[model samples]
Target: MKVLPRQRKAVLINSVLGVAVLAGAGGAYSAVTSHSDSSARADARTVTVAKGTVLATVSGSGSLSSPSDAGVNFTTGGKLTQVNVKPGDKVSRGQLLGKVDATAAKETLAQDEASLTAAQANLTKVQEGQPSTSTGSGSGSGGSSSRGSANTAPTPTPSPTVDPAQLAQAEAQLTQAQNAVDAAQRAVDGTTLRAPVAGTVASVSAKTGDTVSGTGGNSTAGGSGGGSASGSNSGSTSSGSSSALSGFVVLTNPSGMQVTANFSEADALKLKPGQAATVTLNAESGTVLNAKVLSVSSLPVSSGSGSGGGGGGGNSSGSAVQYAATLTITSPTSNLRTGLSASIQVVTGEASGALSVPTAAVSGTGANRTVTVVNDDGTTQRTPVTVGLEGDSADQILSGLSEGAKVQLASVSASGNGGFPSGAFPGGLGGGAGRTRGGGAGGAGGGFRTGGGGGGRG
Candidate 1:
């Protein structure tokens, strides 16, 4: 085995070179295998692009309230003798709601009547030709003084007469008495409180023995005295007076039920009077109350301000602005009651039998939509698409893809990049040409070829 040093060195170098080459080839093979495994895992995700319908809805919470709520109060101050209706009692328009103790009112009325009668009698007596006793002393001193002459010659002027002043005073007193009588009569009328409208009794503030009074405890009756009455003015003011009549028996017509929705100013602009709405109460599920927008207040409704986002976000707890939108119930249910929580869904727009795909299947920057479609050969292709009306679950695709094409949902990831596989062609490759066998057009045993038109790539 004797060998030259140069020959041995050459053989060693060759062996070293061979080892390095083998290492490089092995590394390349491992990398390729790892990449292929990752791609297989990505392809396992099932995505479906289907033909379906979608609906967009605006949801807002509100409370049930009555459009017309009336409070019944006593016009005159007295003990409540009788409460004809209790809370929850149905009543009719002009039905007797309650009665107050009229003993004091009646007695005052009697006194006023007596005074008026006396005044009228005095007036009659004055009108009639009645003789009155007068005292006048005419002495013969006049003659005696005239005869005595010299020292005392004086004459007395007759006192000026003004008899109309006494008559005027009497007329004024008569007018005052007549006014008192009229006022007393009105107070008597106020003793009986009647329902102003047909409705159910929402609340009863006054019991049978409770004392009711007018504003400032003033008389409810007015007279020719030209003084304004208290309760006879406005009912709202009448009920706001004192504790005796502070709270009132509320009467509400159930049919007049309305939903008070607090909407943001932006959403309010989309709503209009006479728009249809569906109301769902908290207690009732699967039941909808039909309603219409009765009115939208020009003024904004003040509410607690808060952030708009649902979950934890930047200052979501902060204040929010809202406005009141009143909706009248077109069809009311018996179970609906005041103070119940409700949700309203207002349909802004609707499409019947429109084509749509899962919202997840469509992806893009705002207003520019794209989707990743799965090719028949187990590869992904991103296709640029023109989208139409968006909905809860799906979107309308205007163009760029045909029905029954498989689309991939944006691969959800914790990072939110949509986890699309790298190097994968979108829409089955560019220029309307798909991956093919033998890597040539019209090649024998080649895979499906794309159309001649150019398109986007995945």
Candidate 2:
């Protein structure tokens, strides 16, 4: 058959256009299918409810501290003469840590002792008989002296009597002198620093020959006398300028090592003394220690001015109120040190041998809690459930679905979008070819039909 060049060229162009249209349609269909497959993979999976144990725990981060941590300081200011202990030295209660020069103190004591001795002697004389220089005039003696001139012998003065008033004055003076002597002795003793409690020296800020004002760091170790979070503002040795660590020496009772953590108000309310707790050190993640809640502070961490807690364990930032909690390590290791960061988990509630399901399968809370049950017929139904002891991995199901009942896990992706691209052009090439044949195709349908038919028939 003979064909003109112009006609042939038109036919060739139509054939190419038709092939392009088919290729576009195929690509669109493949994209939609791939997206649907990924969405399915991201969807929910079914799990059977069964009997298990669930532990409800309140978790928080904190730091290691010792209730028996004491900041040893000199009671009176003087030149530091001797330091017997350094950091890491073990000492007993009343052990002398260091001393300031006691020369002036000794001098004061000597003067007070002399005064006390003089006062004692004066008191003794008053109690016996105070010598009276005043002569007593007697009527008989006066008459005799008037009659017999100088020959009348002066009657011997009666033996001196102790005046009650004079005795009382002397006793009072003695008491005053005794008190002064005791005070002087205490001043002399105050020149030396002693450990208030038995513990290891955690740090020493003062050295021999340094003059200390003795104005700060007078806190007693074992604060408040129990296993309670003192929330002390003690700073770590990591910072040199911290005044909290600026004591003569920092003493820590290694045996009293405990953890101090802060919990939100919601969690704090659920915590109480004697609750079982677990502590994990931040530096040693694998080391787990058993402990129990020793105390929970009634006031927020920010509200208290406690100088008892070691390391800034409680959270004082943010608008939320955080309560300090103390946990005692039942079996502490020798390696445990104050100011070490740790995470705490206290078991607040527990349920055993109860019907439970994966926590992810449950939605909502309280009386309105619900789960999606997967029926045997492949249908899903939203069912209300009564839950108890909502744990980390699983939740206790009190009712609404028997044991062995299956529930669908919550989907990661949203549902009900028709499995199609939302922003795709309306009735465009993908949609047009997807919905109709050549004559009713979308995206310039009439032109596509003409070129498409010619390419197909050819």
The number of the candidate with the highest lDDT is 2
Candidate 2 per-residue lDDT over residues 1-458, each given as its tens digit: 87669989899999999999989987876776567657755565999988888987888789887656666566556888999998879998778888889898899999999999999999998887945566645447435445445555466665678889999999999999999998788777777777767778877766788886543233343222111111122222221111233366767765667888998677889899999999999999999999999999999985433221111112223355679998888875577877788999899989989999977688775688999998999788999999887776788998897998999986533233234432132232222111111112222122122221111000
- Tell me how far the alpha carbon of residue 168 in candidate 2 is from the true structure, in angstroms, after superposition: 4.7
Predicted structure 1, TM vs. truth: 0.56
Alpha carbon lDDT of each predicted model: 0.60, 0.68
Question: RMSDs, each prediction?
Answer: 16.0, 14.9
lDDT of 1 by residue, 178-294 (tens): 999888888888787777667777667668887766543243322111112334223322221112222346666555677888776656766778777899888887778988888
Using Cα atoms with residue i matched to residue i, what is each candidate's TM-score against the true structure?
0.56, 0.63
Best candidate, TM-score-wise?
Answer: 2
Query: Which pairs clash in the backbone of model 2?
Result: 68-222, 232-306, 232-307, 232-308, 232-309
